[model samples]
Target: MDARQKQLCIGEGFHNIDYRILKSIVDCIYEAVCVIDENGIVIVWNKGAEKLYNIAYKDIIGENIEDIFPDAIVNNVRKTGVSVENKYHSPRENSYILANSMPLYIEKVFKGAVSTDRDFAELIKLYFELENANSKLIFLENEVKKISGVFGNIIGKSPNIVKKIDMARQIAPTHASVMITGESGTGKEVFARGIHELSGRKGLFVPVNCSAIPSELFESEFFGYCAGAFTGANKKGKMGIFELADEGTIFLDEIGDMPLHMQAKLLRVLQEREIVRLGGEKNIKLDLRVLAATNKCLQEMVRESKFREDLYYRLNVVEINLPSLRERKEDIPIFIDYFIKEFSTRNSKKIIGTQRDVLNILNEYKWPGNIRELMNVIEHIIVTNKNGMIQKNSIPEYILSQAKKSESFKEYPLDLTKAIKKLETENIKKALKISKNNKSKAAKLLNIPRGTLYHKIDEYKIKCPK
Candidate 1:
């Protein structure tokens, strides 16, 4: 060879090297490399390709490419003489890899195709982990803010409420299942969220209301499903609530509402620490804490055959019973003051504190709906009375009628104008009911001018039921 030709051959080392040396060099490449002849026969199958597809080169070389591999990109390149880059899936390896394929030509004559593949499974796993971590961080921040000062979103300082919070905090760090029992609207979710924050888990908090999910979809929603697992299934499949809640807290609100059949399934998951999808054979392991809440008496339900006995015990590792609003009446004024400020800022209102008469009446009322009802009442008062101090007349009619005031009118001063307005409102409502809500007829029934009736209706903001 001439000096220039020898330099070229040496520069391209494989051109003059032994076949074994060239094969070793190809095997050293990290990415999968494969070359096919013009007759669609496999000529080169590197070590990376064997590792990626789990197929040995000995079995693949000299074999028809179509018989050894089902990848369509190689055939497409040979047919169209075009290069293509895409994500490819290998069913044998159950893996996905980035693949690039280009037509190979010898002196402008089409020969075959060469392809390279890069596996991205590890990168995809890391991406999901980072996303899950970010979600957990956001949730923890919010939970910290909610219970930051004294009791997070729970707005009570009474002994009953404080004791419950202390118990929640004590059990927060453990992986024990917590059962929060209370009447509806007793801030059960607040305690659940607070406990999750304190637990310091590195996964997002997932809350599922047992009563909200349809019975037929319960299994699919909780355990997930594989692609083509059932008719109408998503082609890519879906992750279940438990899988999504891995390394986090799953707050199952109203656990008593879970049907008997599903309760058995839940019991198995808790016991096994794993779940098999609705239409899948694989069992997915779980690392999660379950927090359940219910207004119903689970023990009683168990006795009555309404709830599973074993599942109840599994979920009742720790129990926190929230006191009703009436049981902790001392916290009423505190909650009222806090809510007044909260709703005032939210609604851009300048209204002030509740009057003594209103506070006394509110404290005496039996709040069947608990803290949630109290918040609603406060919101209503702030929205209805935006100009001055909140008055007793702003209270809902049902509450005012049911509430037992401790001090009589003689003991506590009353607003005469408000009482008169209330009386007038009652009369106008009765007249409208009698007249079937015909404004002119109602005015005649009440012996008032139609204009006066309109003014009174606007003044009271009365909404007549149709």
Candidate 2:
């Protein structure tokens, strides 16, 4: 047989063979592949190569690889008779690819080289998807830790609540100041304590309600007074909260209620990391983490000039916004079960559960006071019922009334499309607000790609207020 016939010949197992059939199999491969002779001339170019490089096999065959795909490894391997493995190369603009090239030797004589390429962009896209999935899993794990008694034994499994718990867990180990924002009964203090506990701080966790501390006494309460500092001051002298919180965490609840003058002093303390007692002359340095919580809108307060912008920015380095009980209604049942078991165990009652009607009523009513209100109602039931399951008539009068009103009230048509759009818009706005106008974080919060978020923003014409 001639040399051409020998190259086309199949092994002894095959009786009849066609070169076209072999070429067809090679062309069907997904990875770009190429073969070159010892002189660096293209001898075989598969269909994958044509699609990847946007050049036909007929155009590249018999031509020098250097003229077209100049960076092809086939040329290098042909020259040195050495194989190149897993090399990254970009043959065209925006075309990133990984390739493997090996020299072909027959009977100890150099012949040519074969190279295959895989699209790098596709691999990168898949990697990003995997990372996003891992982030979600971490969020769920952190939420599970919270309700299972790892941190303050929190209870709730709604997506928004879980996301906030996850964020707190991520930032707890750091010394960065955190701001917790939510309505009055949303358990901001609980979230703050959770952060402090997970922070692994050695010092004690001291909590102070800014609204309760009189403006005139703010300085004395925050910083301390020395002996004989004032007429009514303690004779032995008092250490300020900042001092008491050394090497620990001091939770500043209702921070937005701090007076303007006190805000200035607080900003100074944050910047200098030191404080002077009410009557002392010497400055006391502090090493502690500050976790602030508020039921009011700090940004609005900043704009209204009620809160100092500098102080707000300082304490707002890391913010965890808790969702209200009404917003995360899915967690109502969980909370109901948790609070029942808690109150029952504590009160020495054998209350097993609540009736279905009672749960429906509780879930339907908007919890204006959030979890605090929910706990109070549960305790009321446990105390009043004392035994057996809680019934509809046993619930609070206000909750039953609210549930009746909610059921009777009517809104626009319950079209699924419109409802979905409204929900989407509300979620987007919430994410943007929580992220402080950071589009990237908002996208993560919404569990969508950044590009998709941008598209939704445009479609909904959502305004980001920061």
Candidate 3:
């Protein structure tokens, strides 16, 4: 009978009413509850307890509790001669049932233990589902990347490179505009491509070299005009980068060199999400990702009043700074192996091996143009290699020259620009003569970085025939 019914039926003669009161108290609890006797006979089972273990009091009252539910009793309580409790599981629904047990004493000695359970199945279910979904998304993301842009993903296992890759992956799936800052040739475009592919936007990667474009062509190049919008315009108007990249990415390289007036126009388009062609009357909606890259220190430019502060803030939401090749020297070996293979296959040359001294020359030398310079060096070496393995002597003279003139100065003095130019020239000549008319080897011989040597050769108006 129910507690209230038994109490009213027995009246003053109800001596076992205390058990009814105990049952009522335990029944109100949220978790499952079970009270067992010395012989492990279940004496009391609460309502919550019944739902958890799929057992009722009527079925378990006279039954041996251990036979029906040994796990439910918490065996530790009996072994240690003390009341014990812990979390237990009911695998039917893959549920977690927390069994909180304590000693039950009939006299001065402990008789049995009473256990209670709290269901934690819901929380466990949610976590597993979230984990599974995340795994699937990551797999699909990798699969989709293969079908996108041809720009290869930057590869390296070094700590520095891995961190940058992780950060790129984290921010790629968002709509936020990105500002990438790095030294020239430090794989800025690679990171930009990664962001574009991750955002799930359609279309292509349209690269605009800000410094390469003339000031007059900026508007026409960015936003295409209508067929009859301007004089001398083509009968069939072309789609602008902004319109062409309607649902894709537009990588603006050398953004630091973009004129101030154009910066304002770019900022306006970003804010309105629309662009107007050079001589067009209507505004075209743009849904493209804007990824800007710069080798110059933009913050310093902002301080010098060259770059606008407002424009900086607008594109500063997601900023990534790429590490220079010198900063990640550990990645040099792997990158060299990659580039060697790349160039060797293309040039039909068999470059069997690279000596440690050659790698030392590459690693120790400052990489001003970063990976691009290194790749070019690898291509040059492979194309000019007479033997299967390139030895220290066979390597570029510019690198060998550094060993000879290593003691020129401990530091490069900025004030002595004339002395610097003179040293640069002498070194360049030695590299050229040693390499036997090869600018690539001569660049390595001088100990001066390759890209800087290229620019210097151009500045001095020296001709190195291809």
Candidate 4:
């Protein structure tokens, strides 16, 4: 049956196979393929090759391939038996191409050459888009590097601060969980961020203000939860802080205040190098560098049974204690100038230097609030004294009040209750003097409720000295 069918087809001489089918296949391929002989004679050129080179295969065959395109530079490929790739055109207009050329080899001998090319017009457009995105990404990276206080962020001339910065830089390359310790106003978080910035991690920083979050939510907040994990959980699920900080740094601020139970969970995460989402079964591998900062001493908390002793040691691989502003007053002028300029530009104000006397007062007065307070003071000065150079007079009443705060109240024949009342009055008067009687801001600085401060003022009959 097969022989008869084949004989009938041969007799009719109608195979019906079309060459267009072959050419159609070549035209559809995105990459242009070209084949040439030893003398650089174009033997096989696909439609894609023709369209790409802007010359038809019919026009190129039997012609010297090198002389035909000129830009093809086929002579070099023939002479050297080497292929060229991604070579740019010397005089290009709207387009470019990525060429992959290979000298055709058969039985260990070079026969001719074959090439494939991809149009760069679309690729160049993509490259420009990529370049724009990369430029913006780099700018953002630079900005983040600055804010994170890496090499570029730690700005200060004071030897003490510089020494600390140098130490931080020395330790930045290691994969260590650094514990930064300092008073509430010291720049502990800055050091933590600086460590992360220096580590070259591209992940987002996840800072957990341990004191700010409610204890019940710690596990869910740090390790996240699967969908339907909790009664009111998000349907699609959530990515926890630790997951977000993967391959990056997690800054646990106020670590001393972290709850004992949460501290235990944190210890497990540190030890296991992984975390299981709350109310979920799977364990997520965590690749994170933990940087913790606290005003309260962990050793003290551990002794008091408030902090887990095990966690303390785990987090304290390296410790960087930020110096209080009082200890680093020499850095104050540097800080002051930096802050004033920043706020001036942000607030768009013309305010500049405080009087020399005021600067001296700033230097002398103990900045209990540290860097944060200094920055706020600069902002306040700019807001309040907007038009002119700041003066000693423009300095807030608080700076001046410290000197007068110790003065005793003038009274005679002091009764036990009256004497106590007089002392209270004197203290309140001093606070008013220092705060310039800005009760609200004064209350903030004093770390007390505004209502409580007002009650005390009423009870003591405190007034600003005229």
Candidate 5:
């Protein structure tokens, strides 16, 4: 064969093989794949890209990518010789995509750029669907609790909790102001809600987070405001929390956080049962009940002049203190069972129960965050649990470490006399070890007389290292 014929044959063979490989690999990918030349001209547009952009390869292959898709990531990659990974892009309206683009280099020179993109519309849709489902589940849970009773949400059968429940029921029907005090996350809000439900009021229950309202907006937020009251104010005016809770109950959470001036205003409103809207002269009479909760010592605040004594006296008509989890440890198992069922149903898990060991560890834990922390731990366990039961390893590592520390502490005596003796014994042994069994040096190290040290060693019967 002649030289020209041989060269033509080789060129045809190479073109056929390259075309086959490109069609099989790049064109078959599910994610959109596009390649551009050195001048931002489209060289390869896969079927995925065609489907995503709604433009065919024949129509776009030879076109400059800038004209077709001005903000294409491949164009930036070619111009800057820089790569972009997992970047958010919206090529068209309502089209969300996550794209990875890289500059293609051949022999240390920039050749072009290639990009792969995955549509995120489906993922976003699924996320919204999950959130909707969770909302429905929570609504159903609250409805179920309501059906049970007014105090159904507060889960405890301990003496303290039961006593508090009875007291709450006795006072719920009255119009007296109640002060619910407890440590944070000890179901103070739940108790307040129960009181409202039992009150048989015909108005809405408006919960006001005293700490969250800005000081500047306190008056307007607690009372109604007239239209055009201030710049950026709602044109139709707004009803403050107290006004909204007319003829019902207003739950003031974190009441201690109310500023001194606001406290005076609140006291006046409560005493008069009337509120005059901001920028208006007419006093609006209200029949709402007030229930305030705090995780602070209002008595101490009164002594320090941080809180108003008159307001304290008015709000504390009846004080009901909720017991902390540590104070009511016997109720831990009940809370665990309740939370397990709730979380299991939410997560679509069939978790029958936790292992006895897991329960033991959880019960031993001093839940500083109280019921809130326990609820979170149960949710975590339900989410991570694979089997039908919650195993020891499924518990959070932090809880396990804390439980271990508690167990170690439990080995020591709690009695004052015995604790002191035990601590003395351990220190004596440590001193002896540090002094290499020399009694005189050990006594000096312990800062105790040698005679006393000898008496301690004999009393405690501590063995010395030979």
Candidate 6:
């Protein structure tokens, strides 16, 4: 081989073998590979380069690379005898590459430069696609946050309250019937409204108080009577609660109070998804969701045949039970703050906050009336108070009397060690209660490590609920 071809070999010892091996190695590489001589003439161009640049090796071999690729990194390496590592380059419009060019030297003579380029066009396309997908995901998350904000009215961050709110969000998007069970004044209607808002149903939310509707007027009130169907009916006819809530949600408040006779008709409407107006032959279809709330134990009533078992099962597809105020006392302080601000704004008052002693007394008292009682108490304070801060005298006498009675029953310990141990055990128990006996969550609530919490539990002989 002549001197021009000999330069392609790495060294004299393995000239033929090394030249064939190097050629084979370059051929195997997927990245675009190009080599130029000291004069910037193209000597090696692999198939990758041909596909990337749309230039054939046979047509470009022995030609000046600068004439075809003026911005090529190989030309720069050949001129400067310097290496370029992982540099980004754009050879033409819509073409991008990451290239690494190294100066080739044999016997202290700069032979040429070798470059390998990775096409970045596909990578850029994928990056844009990922960015678009991320934007859509962020939008969906924001929408969910907006929907969840409706629950902000329910208040309280206790584990029980949080679990109920989470369960509400999970079932809101589906068409399943939800049964909200809690004590009276526990804000069951608030939960039902929040669910309807998140359900994506466009129709109005029609609330029906079963106890308030007379049994004689149940059919006409629920399924509107047609013109002349009744002696005093409107000539144009009227829409009943079910028809008014078409394509929306029907909140059956006090569902347990519905008479047994009306329960069968309601069940038929739910199963048939249609209702016939009184004296009307046509059956009007309904596309609606049902949400029910009750303060009574329907399960026990079902056993007694007071509530229809079949209707009970149909409405109780998913049950969300709200905790009473006494069950989540940790949230009372915030509840106080929320109600104070709400009443203050409505009543045009600037009550800054409640006195610390007043808060202590309020916290100690068990709120049997739940959030409704708390709201009433705050409203009473806001309305009667003449000063900026809520004082003990401004609170109702009933609550004050109850708090004094509760304080009289408490005992105090003088020993420092014993007091400390008692306080620790009480706090640990409170943490366990708040976390629903989840050891990890309880430890977090107590601001202690899991191991330390376990040790304390064992040392105090505390019984954790299952």
Q: Could you say which candidate leads in TM-score?
A: 5
lDDT, model 2, position 97 = 90
Worst lDDT 10-window in candidate 3: 6-15
Worst 10 residues of 4 by lDDT: 6-15
Q: What TM-score do all the candidates reach, one by one?
A: 0.56, 0.56, 0.55, 0.56, 0.61, 0.56
The TM-score measured for candidate 2 stands at 0.56
Against the hidden true structure, what lDDT does model 2 obtain? 0.82
Using lDDT as the measure, the top candidate is 5
lDDT of each: 0.82, 0.82, 0.75, 0.75, 0.86, 0.85
lDDT of 6 by residue, 173-206 (tens): 8999999999988889889888888888899888
lDDT of 4 at 133: 64
Output the lDDT of residue 82, model 5. 83
List where candidate 3 sits over 4 angstroms from the true fold: 1-152, 407-466
On a 0 to 100 scale, what is the lDDT of residue 323 in model 5? Answer: 94
lDDT of 1 by residue, 1-466 (tens): 3445433433332243475676788899988898776667666679998998888877776666787556556766777888988756563456777778998876677768888887778556776567556655655664578754234677777899989999988989888999999999998888998899899898878989999999999999999999998899999899999999999999999999998999999999898999998778988999999999999999999999999889999999999999998889999889888777666655656664668989888888878988899999999998888556888899999888776443334433378888778777888898888888888988998899999999999989977646
* Stretches of model 2 off by over 4 angstroms after superposition: 1-152, 410-466
List model 2 lDDT by residue over 158-254, tens digit each: 8998898889889999999999999989988888888888888889889999999888888888899999998999999999899999998999999
Candidate 3 lands at a TM-score of: 0.55
Tens-place lDDT digits, model 5, residues 307-401: 99999999999999999999999999999988887777677666656689999999988899999999999999999988777899988999999
For residues 46-69, what per-residue lDDT tens digits would candidate 3 score against the true structure? 898788777766766655566765
Measured with C-alpha atoms, the lDDT of residue 24 in candidate 3 is 85
* Clashing pairs in model 2, backbone N/Cα/C closer than 3 A: none
lDDT tens digits by residue: candidate 4, 319-393: 888888888778888888877766655554656356887787778778888888888887888777745698876
